[model samples]
Target: MWIEGAKQAGVEAHPWDNLAEEPLPTSVEIEGTTVPVKWLPKPELGESGGDLRNVVFVYESAEPHLRLRWQWQARGDFGPVEHRITIENLGGQEVWLLMVDSLRLDWKVTPTQNLRNVYVEKGADSPSAEGTHLETVSDGYNWKGKSSTYAHPVKDEKREIIPAEIVCDSNGNGWYAGVEFSGRTRISLERNGTSLKSVLGLDPEPGPFKTRLGPGETFETPTVFLGAFRGGPDGAGNQLRPWVRAVLGNPVTWKDPQYPLMVNNSWGSGMQVDEPLALKMIGESKELGLEMFHVDAGWFRGVGDWYSEPKKFPHGLAFIADAAHREGLRFGIWTDWTQAALDTESGALNVRDPKVSDWLVTDLKPDWKPEDFKGQTIDIGVPEAHDWAAKEVKRIVEDYHLDMLEHDGYLVAQGCVQTDHPHGPPNRSTMRVIHDWASDFVLASNSTDVSYHAVRAYYDIYEKTRREHPGLLFEICNDGSRMVDFGSAAHGDYFSITDTYDPLSNRRAFYDTSHLLPAAMLESYVEKWPVPKPENFLYMLRSGMMGWITIMTDTTAWTPEQHEAARKAFELYKAQLRPFIRDAQMFHISARPDGVHWDGLEYWDATRGKGVVYAFRGSIPDEAGHHFILAGLQANKHYRLHFEDGSQPDHEVSGSELLGQGLSVRLWNPLSSELVFLDEVAARK
Candidate 1:
C-alpha cells in the first residue's frame, strides 16, 4: 500500500516480496484448502487531506476463497502510517483465519551504518524497582525473549518483554513503528544490507481457538503504525504523538476544562469514604484550586450496585455531589462497571437471575457452580445489558448531579458462547457488539465515528451518558496502566497512569507515558501512603505536574503547615503548568531514574513562547547537577528564566543559547527537585 503523506516526507518503497515466506502474510483455510493471497492495488483512495490520508490495497486469493482489505493511513506530512487489515470471507463456505499480520512493509531510507533499534522494558508489579526502561535493540538480545509462551501458568515466570513501540534510529534520521493493540503484540525489525524490513502484528499467545469467519464475515486486525523521522528518537516520538492524538481525538474535543486538576479520595480514605469525609475533601480540594473532586471506589454499595452505601452516605450520594457543586468543583465517582462482586447479594442480579443471566458474559469453569464464581462479567453485547448499563450510568449522574464518571475495569470482554445472548453463537467476539453500539450511539448523538473496537463500548457508554448529561467527563483506568493505549484515550477524557503511591514509579511512568500520550490526557497522582517529608512531598507533587495533577492524600491528616504548603503547591502548578499542559508538547531531557541519577522532562508550547522544565534528583549518589538543551523554542527570541526552588537567580538567555548551548542547573541535595520556568522575553525597544 502507498501512503501519499509518507511519499511527501521523502519516503520511498522498495519492490520486495512481502509473502515469499513459509508463514504467509495472511493464512486462511476454506473447505480444508489453504489459499495464497496476492495484493492488488485498489482504484480509489480512502480518507484524504488535513495532515492525514488513507490508501487501501486489496489482497485476494487466486480462487474465490477470501479477500483482505489493507487500509494504510498516514498522519501529518512526516507523521506515522497506521495500517489495519480487514479479512472478508469471499466464499460461501466457512473460513478459518489462521494468521493475519497487522503490518508488513519494506522500505529503503537514507543509508547510514549508525542505525540502532530502540525498545522499552516494563518492570514487574513490585513497587521499588517498577518502571519503564528503555533499551537499544542488539544482537543476541531478543526483546520478546527466546520462547514465545502465551499466558504462562506462573505469573512472574514470564520472560522480560518490551513495549509495542519500536524505533530504528541513526544519528540523524530514524524509523519508528508501534502496534496499537493493548494486548500482546509483536514488532520486529531486520536489516539486510542497506534495506530494512519491519513486521508487526498481534502476538496471540498459544491458544486453542481460531477466528472463524463465515460467508461475508469480516475481521479487522489491530492497527500498526509506521513512520520515519529526520531526527533521532525525539523526532520519532514527535511523529508518532500527533498521529496517536489524531486517532484518539484530543481531550478538549469532548469537554471543557480539557486538562482538569483533580483531587481524588482514593488513597486518602480508601474504601471507607463517608459523606462527612467526602464533603471535607471537597472543601479542601476547592481551597487547593482543584477543578474536580473524584470519589474513587467504595461510594457504591457493591461492584454492580450503583446506589450509594446507606451507612456511609446516609443522605445519599447526591449530598457529596451537591457539596462539591456548592464549592464550585466538578463531582466524579468511580465504578468497575464491567464486573460484579460475586460475594454480594447484588451479584445474583447479574449472575443467577434469569432475566439478567443473559446480560452477563461470565464464563464459568467446567462443571463449576455459579456460587463459586468470584466475579460476574457483564455482557454489554446483549441489548438489554447495554441498556441496563446506560440506564445505571444515567441514573447515577442524574441523581448525584455528577460532572464526571471514572470507568475502571478490564478491557476485553470474555467471549460469551451462550446462544440466548443477543449477540452470540458462532461469532463470540465482543468486538462486533462494541462496533454496532458505538456506530448507533455516534449516529444518534450526531458525532463522528472513529472505528476503534477496543474502546467502542467505552465510547458508547460515555457518549450515551453525555448526550443526556452534557459536559460529562469520563476517565478510563484499567487497573493501572494496562490499557493505556489509543483505544482507551479515544473515549476517556484522561487516564490514570497507575494506582500505586510510589513517588519514583509515578515519576518514571510520567516520563515514559509522555512519549506516546499528550500531557493533558495523562494524569499522575501523589500517593497518600508512606507520606514523604515536606521536600519529598513537594518533589512528588512536582513530578505529577508534568501532566494533569491529582492529589490523593487526606487533607484532614495534614498539619497546618502541610495543608498550607499543599495549597501553595496547587497554586504553583496551576500558575506554572496548567496553562500549557493542554496544548504544550513534552520533551524528555533525562533518562528514567534508577535512583542514582536525576530524572526530568520539559513541556513547551511554542505558540505561547513559554515552557517549564521539571527535574528531580533521586536518593542515590551520582551528579550534583545536570544540564540539557531545551526543545521547542524560538531560536532568535530571548528568554527569561525563573527558578521555583530558589536554587538559581533570575536570568536571561536567548532561545538559541538555551537550545544550542543548553540550560544548566544544580539540585545540590539528593531526593530533591526543581522546576525551571522559561518565557520568551519581550523584545527590547
Candidate 2:
C-alpha cells in the first residue's frame, strides 16, 4: 500500500528531471507494479504534423483506493514545451487525485506556490485575512494552498496563477466540482459517483483523447476532468470522463454534528403576521425542535422602506421576533431593499427632505406620486437614499432582535431610474446604478446576523453579490427545474429545482437533480406557495430534511393533516440538518426522463460518521413494485428500509444486497422510495 519513495499510500513525488527524453513509452514502477507511460504531441504547441497524441501514464497501486500518475514531453525541439497530464479509471476504489498546482506556458512553469502577493479582499484596510495559496513540501510533493474567491480581484486575467485546491475526506465525499483558468488554459472537473467515467487529452489536441473504463464487474465511480485551452469546450468530452470517475472514487465524508432543520413561513408579500397565526406557528415550530422561523414578506407595508404595519399585527412586529426568541427559535425577516411602492397609501413615499431630495420616491411620470404612485422604483445609490433605508431597517432589526434577514428583489431594481437630481450622471442604466446601491446597502448594515438573499433573475448580479458576501447563503430560483443547470449553480448555495409544484410529484425531480449534482446543488422552495397543500408541504419537508428545505404556507389555512405534517416535518428536518450541511453525498439510482418513476440516492453525514439514505419515486398512479439501487453503503452492512407510511409501505434490505451484489431490484409499490439505515458493519471495505 506504500509507494517506493514515500511512506504512505497517498504521497505524490515529482522530482524535476533535466533529461530530455527518457524513452518512447516508459514505465513508472510503484509498489512493485509498473504503469505504462508515454508522451504525445501537445496541441498547444501548434504541431504542423506529428504523433498529435498527448501523454498518459497510469500505475496500479497495491492499495484498494489508490492510483499513481506521471507525465512529461520528450520533444526537445519544442523549447519550453508544456505537457498536460490526465488520468482516468472506471473502478470501485478511487485514486488519490490532485492537479499540478502551476501553469506551464512557453516552456515556463509558474507554480501557484506564492499567492500572498496575488490575493486581496477588495476593501480591507489590513492585508485581507483571506485564504491564499502557500506552497508546502508535504510527502516530498509540493502543494499549493487554495484561495477563497473573497480574497482576490477576480479579473479573469491570463497567465495569472489561481489559488491552491484540495479535496479531502471531509470537504468532498462523493463528488466534487472546480474550475482552473490561467489566462490561456482552463480545466474544469465534475465527478460522477459511479459508472462510465472518462479521462481526457489536452496537448496536440483538436478533441479529447478519452479513456473509458469501470470496475471489474459494472462501471462505478464515473469521473471526468474536462480540460480546455483558452477556456472552451473543444477538449471537454475527453477530460470529462476521467474527472468524474476520480471524484466519485475519492472518499466521501463530512462533519455535520447537529441536526437542526425546521419549518418556515414565507408566502406572497408572503409572510404577513396575523399575530394569532404567527404565535401558533412559532409555538408549533418550537415544539417540533424547529430551530428557526422566517417571517417572509408582507410584514412591512412599504417595499423599499422598512417598517411593520401595526394594524396588521396589532401587537407590534417586535412581538413576533420576541415570541420566536422565547420559543428558542431563530427569527428572520424578509427585505426587498431595491423596490418601493409609490402609491400614496403606502408608507414608503413621504420622504421629500430637500437635502435628500435626490433620494425621492418619484414615479417615471409626475402623476405618480407616493400616495397615487403605481410601479415606482426607489434609487438606493444616492447616499441619502440608503441612509433613509438603514435607519428604518436597523430599527426593525434592533427592536425585534432578529437573527437573519431574508434579502430579496435586487434584480427588480436593475432598470429603475435614479432620478436626474444629482448623484453623478443622469440616465445611467439601472444595472450599473443598482449595483452600486446594493453593495453600499450591505456594507452599511452590519449587525453580525446571518442573512439569506434571493437572486431570482440576472446571473451576473447574483455572482457579484456572492463575491461580496461569502457567508451569505444565496438561493437561485429560475422559476422551475428547467433552469436548473451547472452554469447557474456554481455561484449560489442552493438551486430551487422546481417552483410551485405539488410537493409529492415535484420532490422526485428535486431529489433527481440533487443526486445528479450533489457537491454544488441542493433542493429548495417556498413550500405551498400560492396555495396550501399538506401533501406538497410533506414532500418538500421530507426532501429538504436531506438537503436545503424552505416552506411557504398560509399559516391561517393549514388543515389538521397539514398541521401534523408540518410538526413532524419540522422534527425530521431538525434531525437531518447536521448531515445536510456536512457530507451530503448523492448517487443516482434511476432517472425517468418521461416523468414516470424517478429514482436517486442521498446520504447526509457521510464524512463525519453515521449517515441516512434517501430514495424517492416519481409520480405513479398505479400499483407496481418500484425498485432502485442504493449507494454510499458498506459491503458488509445490514440496512432497514422505511417509507413515508401512507406514502409507501415499509421494507428492509442489506447494504451488501443493494450495492455489493451488482444487482437491481423492483417493488410493487408505485411512485415511492425506501429510506435505508445500516445497523452494524465493519469500516468501509
Candidate 3:
C-alpha cells in the first residue's frame, strides 16, 4: 500500500494528487487473494469543463469479469480532490469483497521527523478538556481515530474524533484527509522507519469484514477527500471551509438570505410546555427579532407516539405551526423518529407489538418501561424498519406543516445483536450492553456492519424527503454534538454542537468545532444561564452568536431592560454580523474561553473587505484591557474601526499597527462583551 514520494532533503513530499499515481491508490481483496489492477483510461470524461473536472479510470484485473471503477472528481479547480472505488461483480457467481480501503498514502519521512498531528473530538455529551488535540508524531507513533452515528468515549480513552486528520510541520505545510460516510469509519496514521502511512475508509474492526457482491451487484467504498496545504491549521481550514460550502453544502439552503436563521427554542421550560406557553413564546419570538420558534422534547402524546398531547394542545401541532407562520416565523419540532416505546395508541410505534418487536435492537426485559421521552432503539438496517421510518418522517412533516425538523438523541443504530438483519449476525459472545443516559447501547462484533447499513438507509430517507420538500431544513443533533462530521454536513442543514449550554462551554465547543466546519453550520444552543446583569446577558448571548445560534430560553420571562437589550442584539446580529458570520474566515484571536481572562473570535471576509472582532472580558477583575493581534488583512491598508458598544472612541489605524501592535480592548466590568468592527479605508491620494 506504500506509494513513492518526491524526495526533498531525503524526505518525500506527500503526494497531493492521489488519483494520478501509478498502479492505483487503493485495492480490493477477494476472499484472501489481493486482486491486481491496471488502468484502462476512458475517452469521454463526462463534464470535464471549466471549474469542474470529472474522470473515470477503468481498472481491469486478471479475471475477465471483475473490474474496478475508480471515479475521481472535484467541483472546483482548487481545494481537495475526492475519489471512491467501485467493485463490480459482472460474472455469474457471487464473491466476497473485503478490505477495500478508500485511501492509502505512504509519506516517507526521516526517523527524526518533527510534525504535529491535529484532530478535533465530537462534543457528544459535553465539551471535554481535550476537544481539539494536537500532538507530536515521532519515529514510533501510531494513532487511530473513529467516527459513527453517535460518539461513545469511556474514561481515559482517546475521544472519538470528527473522522479527519492533519499531519503538518511547525510551519503548517502538510496534507489533510477525511471520510464522507456517516457510519462506522476510521482514520489511522502510523510511522515506521521511513514510512508514515495513513489509511482511511470503512473500519473493519472486531473481526472478519465481509460484504457479498452477487453477479451484477456493485459495492462502493466511502468517498474520501485529501488535500495538501502550506499554511497551518487555520490556513488549512480557510481553504477547506469554502470548498465544503461549494461542494457539500445545499444550494437551496444557501440561497435563502437567512439560511442560518436565529432560533428561539422552548427547552427553557424543559418538558413541561403547554399550548399557552408555546403561544406566548411565539409572540415573544417575533418581538425579539428571532426568525424561528422551536418546540423541543414535549408536545407529544407519548414516547414513540408522534401525535400532539390532547391536553397540552387540543388543536394539534398544526395549530402551533399556523401561529408561528402568522408571526412570520418558521416552526420546527423535535423528534426521535427511530425510537420505539410501549405506547398502544393507534399510530404509535409500540415496541411490544409483534411486528415492531422484531425491529428492536435487543429483547427488552419483561417488565421494561419507557422513559417519558427516551425509548428503545430500532434497527433501521432492516428494510421493513427502514421503509416504515421513511414513511413516518414524510407523514409527520406534512401533518404538522413543519418548516424544519430536528432529530435529537441516538436516532441511528451503531450496534445491534440481530443475525437476521442485512448487516449479518453478530458474535453473541461479544454482545455487551450498557445502560447510559436512559437508553441501552449494544456492542458486538458486527457493530461497524450494523452502522454501515443503517447510515446508508438514513441517507436514503433524507434524500427522498428533500426531493419531495425542497425547502424543508433538517437539523442533525445527536443529543447535541455527536454527529458533527463531513457526512452529516452533506445531509443536514446544521448541527447542535454541544449538550452543555453555559457561555464558556458554548464558546469552547465552537472554538474546537469551527476548525473543521463552516461557522454558519455549527449551532450553539444558548440555554438559560446565570445572566445577573445586562452586560452578562450580552456576554452570554454573544458567546453563542459566533455561529448558528439557538436561544433555548423563555423570552417572555426577561425583564424589560433585558428584553430591550436582547432586541437590539438580535437586530445587530441580523444586520451587521450575519454576513461575516456566514461567509468570513474565522480565527481564534485570543486563548480559548476560560472565563478568567479575555477571549474573542475574529471574522475577516477578504472578499467583502471588512470584518468584526467579538471580544469578551472574563471574571478576572484586574485584567481590564487585553491586546489582540488580528489575521486576514492587508499589511499596508488603512482601516476604520467602529465600536458597537462605544466602549472606546471610533478610530482609524494602519493594518500593520492592528496586526503587530495589536488592537486594545478595555472593559470596566467582568462578564462583559464588545463588538469592534473594521473595514478597509481609501488610501490617501
**Top model by lDDT, which number?**
3
User: Each candidate's lDDT (Cα)?
Assistant: 0.61, 0.37, 0.83
Q: Total backbone clashes of model 3?
A: 1
lDDT per residue for candidate 3 within 583-683, as digits (tens), equals 99888788767889998889998887899999999999999999889888888998999989899999998899889978899988999999999999988
Kindly report which residue stretches of model 2 are placed more than 4 angstroms away from their true locations once superposed. Answer: 1-260, 266-272, 287-289, 343-363, 367-393, 411-498, 504-523, 529-540, 555-562, 576-581, 592-595, 604-610, 634-656, 660-673, 683-685
- Every candidate's CA RMSD: 7.1, 19.0, 3.9
Q: Where in model 3 is the C-alpha error above 4 Å?
A: 1-52, 60-65, 91-94, 110-113
After TM-score superposition, the amount by which residue 476's alpha carbon in candidate 3 deviates from its true location, in angstroms, is 0.6
lDDT of 1 by residue, 641-681 (tens): 99987889989988888888788888766777888898889
Backbone clash numbers for all candidates listed: 0, 53, 1
Task: Rate residue 263 of model 2 by lDDT.
Answer: 39
Query: What are the per-residue Cα lDDT tens digits for candidate 2 across 379-418?
Result: 5434455455545445555666665554443222212233
Error of 3 at 120 (Å): 0.7
- Worst lDDT 10-window in candidate 1: 440-449
